[model samples]
Target: MECKNDYLCEKQINMDKLFEYSNRLIKETDTKFFRYMYDEINWKNRMIGLIGPRGVGKTTLVLQYIKQNLNPSETLYVTAEDFYFVDNRFTDLADTFVKYGGKYLFIDEIHYPNLNKIQTFPYNSLINSYSLSCQF
Candidate 1:
Protein backbone atom coordinates (compact mmCIF):
# COMPACT_ATOMS: atom_id res chain seq x y z
CA MET A 1 0.00 0.00 0.00
CA GLU A 2 1.41 3.29 -1.09
CA CYS A 3 1.10 6.28 1.23
CA LYS A 4 -1.08 9.05 -0.09
CA ASN A 5 0.92 12.13 -1.06
CA ASP A 6 -1.15 14.15 1.36
CA TYR A 7 0.06 12.13 4.30
CA LEU A 8 3.45 13.79 4.13
CA CYS A 9 1.79 17.17 4.10
CA GLU A 10 -0.23 16.22 7.15
CA LYS A 11 3.07 15.47 8.87
CA GLN A 12 4.25 18.92 7.74
CA ILE A 13 6.93 17.42 5.59
CA ASN A 14 7.15 16.94 1.85
CA MET A 15 7.88 13.28 1.26
CA ASP A 16 9.64 13.79 -2.04
CA LYS A 17 11.60 16.71 -0.73
CA LEU A 18 12.46 14.81 2.43
CA PHE A 19 13.74 11.96 0.28
CA GLU A 20 15.98 14.42 -1.50
CA TYR A 21 17.18 15.76 1.84
CA SER A 22 17.80 12.19 2.90
CA ASN A 23 19.92 11.60 -0.16
CA ARG A 24 22.07 14.58 0.68
CA LEU A 25 22.19 13.55 4.34
CA ILE A 26 23.48 10.16 3.27
CA LYS A 27 26.56 11.81 1.90
CA GLU A 28 27.03 13.99 4.96
CA THR A 29 26.76 11.42 7.80
CA ASP A 30 29.54 9.03 8.75
CA THR A 31 29.20 5.94 6.58
CA LYS A 32 31.08 3.75 9.03
CA PHE A 33 28.73 4.54 11.90
CA PHE A 34 25.64 3.82 9.84
CA ARG A 35 27.11 0.56 8.58
CA TYR A 36 27.74 -0.50 12.18
CA MET A 37 24.11 0.16 13.17
CA TYR A 38 22.86 -1.58 10.04
CA ASP A 39 24.87 -4.70 10.81
CA GLU A 40 23.90 -4.61 14.48
CA ILE A 41 20.16 -4.08 13.98
CA ASN A 42 18.11 -7.30 13.86
CA TRP A 43 15.60 -5.75 11.46
CA LYS A 44 13.12 -8.50 12.32
CA ASN A 45 11.11 -8.66 15.54
CA ARG A 46 13.56 -6.38 17.34
CA MET A 47 13.40 -3.04 19.09
CA ILE A 48 16.55 -0.87 18.96
CA GLY A 49 17.39 1.82 21.45
CA LEU A 50 20.26 4.16 20.59
CA ILE A 51 21.45 6.09 23.62
CA GLY A 52 24.14 8.72 23.24
CA PRO A 53 25.05 12.28 24.01
CA ARG A 54 23.80 15.19 21.97
CA GLY A 55 25.40 15.87 18.55
CA VAL A 56 26.57 12.27 18.35
CA GLY A 57 24.57 11.76 15.14
CA LYS A 58 22.08 9.14 16.37
CA THR A 59 19.22 10.76 14.50
CA THR A 60 21.35 11.02 11.42
CA LEU A 61 22.02 7.31 11.52
CA VAL A 62 18.30 6.51 11.62
CA LEU A 63 17.60 8.81 8.68
CA GLN A 64 20.46 7.31 6.74
CA TYR A 65 18.97 3.83 7.12
CA ILE A 66 15.55 4.95 5.96
CA LYS A 67 17.06 6.82 3.05
CA GLN A 68 19.19 3.90 1.99
CA ASN A 69 16.95 0.87 2.54
CA LEU A 70 13.29 1.86 2.23
CA ASN A 71 11.15 3.93 -0.02
CA PRO A 72 9.69 7.02 1.62
CA SER A 73 6.22 5.68 0.88
CA GLU A 74 7.00 2.63 3.00
CA THR A 75 8.30 4.53 6.03
CA LEU A 76 7.42 7.34 8.41
CA TYR A 77 10.17 9.33 10.12
CA VAL A 78 9.05 11.56 13.01
CA THR A 79 10.62 13.52 15.83
CA ALA A 80 8.70 13.90 19.07
CA GLU A 81 9.59 17.56 19.24
CA ASP A 82 7.47 18.41 16.25
CA PHE A 83 4.58 20.68 17.18
CA TYR A 84 2.09 18.69 15.14
CA PHE A 85 2.49 15.94 17.70
CA VAL A 86 0.90 18.16 20.35
CA ASP A 87 -2.47 17.65 18.72
CA ASN A 88 -1.87 14.33 16.99
CA ARG A 89 -1.47 11.26 19.14
CA PHE A 90 1.56 9.10 18.40
CA THR A 91 -0.66 6.02 18.22
CA ASP A 92 -2.86 7.75 15.69
CA LEU A 93 0.14 8.51 13.53
CA ALA A 94 1.36 4.94 13.84
CA ASP A 95 -2.09 3.68 12.87
CA THR A 96 -2.11 5.87 9.80
CA PHE A 97 1.32 4.66 8.83
CA VAL A 98 0.25 1.04 9.15
CA LYS A 99 -2.93 1.60 7.18
CA TYR A 100 -0.86 3.07 4.37
CA GLY A 101 1.60 0.14 4.32
CA GLY A 102 4.41 1.59 6.34
CA LYS A 103 6.86 -1.13 7.35
CA TYR A 104 9.56 0.78 9.24
CA LEU A 105 8.93 3.44 11.89
CA PHE A 106 11.76 5.71 13.05
CA ILE A 107 10.94 7.75 16.13
CA ASP A 108 13.46 10.21 17.52
CA GLU A 109 13.73 11.55 21.11
CA ILE A 110 12.19 8.49 22.69
CA HIS A 111 13.49 9.75 26.06
CA TYR A 112 11.17 12.71 26.06
CA PRO A 113 8.77 13.18 28.97
CA ASN A 114 5.64 11.68 27.44
CA LEU A 115 7.36 8.83 25.66
CA ASN A 116 6.54 6.31 28.36
CA LYS A 117 2.87 6.93 27.79
CA ILE A 118 3.32 6.30 24.07
CA GLN A 119 5.29 3.13 24.64
CA THR A 120 2.86 1.66 27.17
CA PHE A 121 0.90 -0.20 24.50
CA PRO A 122 2.44 -2.81 22.26
CA TYR A 123 3.73 -1.20 19.07
CA ASN A 124 2.97 -4.37 17.14
CA SER A 125 -0.66 -3.38 17.59
CA LEU A 126 -0.04 -0.83 14.83
CA ILE A 127 3.02 -1.74 12.75
CA ASN A 128 6.19 -3.78 12.72
CA SER A 129 9.78 -2.54 12.88
CA TYR A 130 9.14 -0.15 15.73
CA SER A 131 12.69 1.18 16.03
CA LEU A 132 13.20 4.00 18.54
CA SER A 133 16.16 6.06 19.71
CA CYS A 134 17.11 9.03 21.86
CA GLN A 135 19.94 11.48 22.53
CA PHE A 136 20.97 10.94 26.09
Candidate 2:
Protein backbone atom coordinates (compact mmCIF):
# COMPACT_ATOMS: atom_id res chain seq x y z
CA MET A 1 0.00 0.00 0.00
CA GLU A 2 1.33 3.39 -0.95
CA CYS A 3 0.58 6.76 0.57
CA LYS A 4 -1.14 9.40 -1.54
CA ASN A 5 -0.13 12.31 0.67
CA ASP A 6 2.47 14.39 -1.16
CA TYR A 7 4.03 15.48 2.10
CA LEU A 8 4.47 11.86 3.13
CA CYS A 9 5.97 11.12 -0.27
CA GLU A 10 8.49 13.87 0.38
CA LYS A 11 9.32 12.30 3.70
CA GLN A 12 9.75 8.94 1.93
CA ILE A 13 12.22 10.59 -0.41
CA ASN A 14 14.12 11.92 2.57
CA MET A 15 14.09 8.44 4.07
CA ASP A 16 15.41 6.89 0.84
CA LYS A 17 18.21 9.43 0.84
CA LEU A 18 19.08 8.56 4.41
CA PHE A 19 19.08 4.86 3.53
CA GLU A 20 21.54 5.52 0.72
CA TYR A 21 23.80 7.41 3.09
CA SER A 22 23.51 4.73 5.78
CA ASN A 23 24.20 1.93 3.28
CA ARG A 24 27.45 3.61 2.31
CA LEU A 25 28.43 3.91 5.96
CA ILE A 26 27.44 0.34 6.68
CA LYS A 27 29.41 -0.91 3.72
CA GLU A 28 32.49 0.92 4.99
CA THR A 29 32.08 -0.31 8.58
CA ASP A 30 34.29 -3.23 9.50
CA THR A 31 32.26 -5.96 11.18
CA LYS A 32 35.43 -7.60 12.53
CA PHE A 33 35.94 -4.74 14.96
CA PHE A 34 33.19 -5.65 17.39
CA ARG A 35 32.51 -3.62 20.52
CA TYR A 36 31.84 -5.24 23.90
CA MET A 37 28.46 -3.54 24.05
CA TYR A 38 27.47 -5.06 20.73
CA ASP A 39 27.44 -8.50 22.27
CA GLU A 40 25.77 -7.15 25.38
CA ILE A 41 22.89 -5.56 23.52
CA ASN A 42 19.84 -7.80 22.98
CA TRP A 43 18.96 -7.14 19.35
CA LYS A 44 15.54 -8.74 19.85
CA ASN A 45 14.29 -5.93 22.05
CA ARG A 46 11.39 -3.82 20.75
CA MET A 47 13.29 -0.64 21.52
CA ILE A 48 16.89 0.01 22.48
CA GLY A 49 18.80 3.16 23.37
CA LEU A 50 22.56 3.41 23.58
CA ILE A 51 23.69 6.38 25.57
CA GLY A 52 27.31 7.36 25.97
CA PRO A 53 29.83 10.00 25.06
CA ARG A 54 30.82 10.80 21.48
CA GLY A 55 33.13 8.46 19.52
CA VAL A 56 31.86 5.51 21.51
CA GLY A 57 31.08 3.49 18.36
CA LYS A 58 27.33 3.37 18.99
CA THR A 59 26.50 4.30 15.42
CA THR A 60 28.97 1.79 14.04
CA LEU A 61 27.54 -0.93 16.26
CA VAL A 62 24.02 -0.31 14.97
CA LEU A 63 25.19 -0.12 11.40
CA GLN A 64 27.02 -3.39 11.76
CA TYR A 65 23.94 -5.05 13.20
CA ILE A 66 21.87 -3.81 10.29
CA LYS A 67 24.43 -5.09 7.85
CA GLN A 68 24.66 -8.53 9.44
CA ASN A 69 21.18 -9.22 10.76
CA LEU A 70 18.30 -7.13 9.49
CA ASN A 71 16.98 -7.03 5.96
CA PRO A 72 17.53 -3.68 4.26
CA SER A 73 13.96 -3.37 3.06
CA GLU A 74 12.64 -3.91 6.59
CA THR A 75 14.94 -1.37 8.23
CA LEU A 76 15.82 2.31 8.15
CA TYR A 77 18.66 4.30 9.67
CA VAL A 78 18.25 8.02 10.18
CA THR A 79 19.93 10.73 12.17
CA ALA A 80 18.36 13.61 14.05
CA GLU A 81 20.75 16.14 12.55
CA ASP A 82 19.68 15.37 9.00
CA PHE A 83 18.21 18.32 7.10
CA TYR A 84 15.05 16.29 6.53
CA PHE A 85 14.05 16.87 10.14
CA VAL A 86 14.28 20.62 9.64
CA ASP A 87 10.84 20.77 8.01
CA ASN A 88 9.44 17.26 8.50
CA ARG A 89 8.28 15.75 11.75
CA PHE A 90 9.84 12.53 12.98
CA THR A 91 6.41 11.02 13.52
CA ASP A 92 5.57 11.69 9.91
CA LEU A 93 8.62 9.75 8.78
CA ALA A 94 7.73 6.88 11.06
CA ASP A 95 4.19 6.80 9.78
CA THR A 96 5.23 6.77 6.15
CA PHE A 97 7.90 4.13 6.69
CA VAL A 98 5.54 1.81 8.52
CA LYS A 99 2.90 2.27 5.88
CA TYR A 100 5.37 0.96 3.35
CA GLY A 101 6.36 -2.05 5.60
CA GLY A 102 9.42 -0.85 7.49
CA LYS A 103 9.87 -2.76 10.73
CA TYR A 104 13.09 -1.68 12.38
CA LEU A 105 14.09 1.98 12.62
CA PHE A 106 17.53 2.89 13.88
CA ILE A 107 17.97 6.55 14.67
CA ASP A 108 21.50 7.80 15.25
CA GLU A 109 22.19 11.04 17.12
CA ILE A 110 18.82 10.66 18.78
CA HIS A 111 19.36 13.56 21.16
CA TYR A 112 19.41 16.29 18.55
CA PRO A 113 15.64 16.62 18.33
CA ASN A 114 13.85 19.00 20.68
CA LEU A 115 12.05 16.94 23.31
CA ASN A 116 9.57 19.71 23.95
CA LYS A 117 8.41 19.84 20.36
CA ILE A 118 8.15 16.09 20.04
CA GLN A 119 5.74 16.05 23.04
CA THR A 120 4.33 13.07 24.91
CA PHE A 121 3.12 9.75 23.38
CA PRO A 122 5.50 10.25 20.49
CA TYR A 123 7.54 7.23 21.47
CA ASN A 124 5.16 4.95 23.33
CA SER A 125 2.23 5.60 21.02
CA LEU A 126 4.37 5.19 17.98
CA ILE A 127 5.45 1.72 19.04
CA ASN A 128 1.94 0.69 20.00
CA SER A 129 0.40 2.14 16.89
CA TYR A 130 2.82 0.77 14.32
CA SER A 131 4.62 -2.07 16.05
CA LEU A 132 7.84 -0.42 14.97
CA SER A 133 11.04 -1.33 16.72
CA CYS A 134 13.42 1.59 17.21
CA GLN A 135 17.02 1.78 18.27
CA PHE A 136 18.76 4.97 19.33
Candidate 3:
Protein backbone atom coordinates (compact mmCIF):
# COMPACT_ATOMS: atom_id res chain seq x y z
CA MET A 1 0.00 0.00 0.00
CA GLU A 2 1.20 3.53 -0.84
CA CYS A 3 0.79 6.73 1.13
CA LYS A 4 -2.33 8.75 0.39
CA ASN A 5 -0.91 12.17 1.33
CA ASP A 6 2.51 12.70 -0.25
CA TYR A 7 3.86 15.64 1.81
CA LEU A 8 3.76 13.67 5.00
CA CYS A 9 6.15 11.10 3.62
CA GLU A 10 6.08 9.79 7.14
CA LYS A 11 3.03 7.84 6.08
CA GLN A 12 5.02 6.30 3.25
CA ILE A 13 7.79 4.82 5.38
CA ASN A 14 7.85 2.86 8.62
CA MET A 15 9.54 5.72 10.45
CA ASP A 16 8.50 4.71 13.94
CA LYS A 17 10.08 1.26 13.76
CA LEU A 18 13.07 2.60 11.90
CA PHE A 19 13.85 5.25 14.51
CA GLU A 20 13.53 2.77 17.32
CA TYR A 21 15.98 0.44 15.61
CA SER A 22 18.38 3.19 14.56
CA ASN A 23 18.46 4.83 17.97
CA ARG A 24 19.18 1.54 19.68
CA LEU A 25 22.25 0.93 17.56
CA ILE A 26 23.54 4.52 17.47
CA LYS A 27 23.75 4.78 21.26
CA GLU A 28 26.60 2.26 21.40
CA THR A 29 30.15 3.45 20.87
CA ASP A 30 31.84 2.62 17.60
CA THR A 31 33.63 -0.70 17.34
CA LYS A 32 37.37 -0.73 17.94
CA PHE A 33 38.29 -2.63 14.77
CA PHE A 34 37.11 -1.68 11.29
CA ARG A 35 35.17 1.27 12.74
CA TYR A 36 38.02 3.48 11.62
CA MET A 37 37.12 2.67 8.02
CA TYR A 38 33.83 4.48 8.47
CA ASP A 39 35.59 7.81 8.66
CA GLU A 40 38.03 6.87 5.89
CA ILE A 41 35.30 5.90 3.45
CA ASN A 42 34.62 8.26 0.58
CA TRP A 43 30.87 8.25 1.08
CA LYS A 44 30.56 10.57 -1.91
CA ASN A 45 31.74 7.84 -4.28
CA ARG A 46 28.90 6.32 -6.29
CA MET A 47 29.60 2.71 -5.29
CA ILE A 48 31.36 1.02 -2.38
CA GLY A 49 31.66 -2.58 -1.32
CA LEU A 50 32.88 -4.38 1.80
CA ILE A 51 33.86 -8.01 1.26
CA GLY A 52 34.79 -10.17 4.22
CA PRO A 53 33.85 -13.14 6.30
CA ARG A 54 31.03 -12.73 8.83
CA GLY A 55 31.43 -11.14 12.32
CA VAL A 56 33.09 -7.97 11.11
CA GLY A 57 31.53 -4.60 12.00
CA LYS A 58 30.48 -3.82 8.44
CA THR A 59 26.81 -3.39 9.29
CA THR A 60 27.60 -1.51 12.45
CA LEU A 61 29.89 0.82 10.57
CA VAL A 62 27.15 1.86 8.17
CA LEU A 63 24.52 2.09 10.92
CA GLN A 64 26.79 4.29 12.96
CA TYR A 65 27.23 6.63 10.02
CA ILE A 66 23.48 6.80 9.51
CA LYS A 67 22.89 7.53 13.18
CA GLN A 68 25.62 10.13 13.37
CA ASN A 69 24.95 12.11 10.20
CA LEU A 70 21.55 11.21 8.79
CA ASN A 71 18.05 11.66 10.12
CA PRO A 72 15.06 9.64 9.03
CA SER A 73 14.20 12.37 6.54
CA GLU A 74 17.51 12.14 4.69
CA THR A 75 18.45 8.46 4.87
CA LEU A 76 16.92 5.01 4.70
CA TYR A 77 18.61 1.78 5.88
CA VAL A 78 17.31 -1.67 5.09
CA THR A 79 18.69 -5.16 4.61
CA ALA A 80 18.11 -6.99 1.36
CA GLU A 81 16.51 -9.81 3.32
CA ASP A 82 14.02 -7.54 5.06
CA PHE A 83 10.38 -8.44 4.65
CA TYR A 84 9.79 -5.03 3.14
CA PHE A 85 11.77 -6.21 0.16
CA VAL A 86 9.53 -9.21 -0.39
CA ASP A 87 6.55 -7.34 -1.82
CA ASN A 88 8.34 -4.20 -2.99
CA ARG A 89 11.21 -3.81 -5.43
CA PHE A 90 14.26 -1.80 -4.49
CA THR A 91 14.02 0.46 -7.52
CA ASP A 92 10.45 1.35 -6.65
CA LEU A 93 11.54 2.20 -3.14
CA ALA A 94 14.26 4.39 -4.61
CA ASP A 95 11.67 6.22 -6.69
CA THR A 96 9.50 6.87 -3.67
CA PHE A 97 12.47 7.96 -1.60
CA VAL A 98 13.54 10.37 -4.32
CA LYS A 99 9.98 11.68 -4.62
CA TYR A 100 10.15 12.56 -0.94
CA GLY A 101 13.59 14.10 -1.53
CA GLY A 102 15.71 11.44 0.13
CA LYS A 103 19.47 11.97 0.15
CA TYR A 104 20.90 8.67 1.41
CA LEU A 105 20.13 4.97 1.21
CA PHE A 106 21.92 2.12 2.98
CA ILE A 107 21.27 -1.46 2.01
CA ASP A 108 22.89 -4.29 3.95
CA GLU A 109 23.17 -7.99 2.96
CA ILE A 110 22.71 -7.27 -0.72
CA HIS A 111 22.93 -10.97 -1.56
CA TYR A 112 19.24 -11.58 -1.27
CA PRO A 113 16.85 -13.39 -3.61
CA ASN A 114 16.10 -11.88 -7.00
CA LEU A 115 19.39 -10.04 -7.32
CA ASN A 116 18.79 -9.80 -11.05
CA LYS A 117 15.93 -7.34 -10.61
CA ILE A 118 18.52 -4.71 -9.91
CA GLN A 119 19.97 -5.22 -13.37
CA THR A 120 16.61 -4.29 -14.86
CA PHE A 121 16.52 -0.93 -13.08
CA PRO A 122 17.59 2.06 -15.16
CA TYR A 123 21.25 2.79 -14.51
CA ASN A 124 20.64 6.47 -13.69
CA SER A 125 17.69 5.60 -11.45
CA LEU A 126 20.02 3.27 -9.57
CA ILE A 127 21.61 6.24 -7.86
CA ASN A 128 18.90 8.85 -8.44
CA SER A 129 20.38 9.90 -5.23
CA TYR A 130 23.32 11.33 -7.18
CA SER A 131 22.89 14.07 -4.68
CA LEU A 132 22.09 11.33 -2.18
CA SER A 133 25.10 9.77 -0.52
CA CYS A 134 25.69 6.75 1.72
CA GLN A 135 28.49 4.28 2.46
CA PHE A 136 28.15 0.50 2.27
The residue pairs that clash in candidate 2, if any, are none
Q: Rank the candidates by TM-score, best first.
A: 2, 3, 1
Clashing pairs in 1: none
User: On residues 1-136, what C-alpha lDDT tens digit does candidate 1 reach at each position?
Assistant: 3445776556534334433443465456564555466667655544466666667767777877766666666666676665546777666656655655666666766545444445554443323222372211
Write model 3 residue lDDT over 1-136, tens digit each, in one string. Answer: 4556874455366544554454566556374445667779876665455545456767777767666667756676666666667766767656765665766766666653334345754343332221223422
User: Model 1 segments beyond 4 Å from truth?
Assistant: 1-35, 113-120, 124-136
Of 1 and 2, the candidate ranking higher by lDDT: 2
Candidate lDDT values, in order: 0.56, 0.70, 0.57
TM-score of each model, in listed order: 0.60, 0.78, 0.64
- Decoy 1 TM-score against native: 0.60
Q: By TM-score, who's the top model here? A: 2
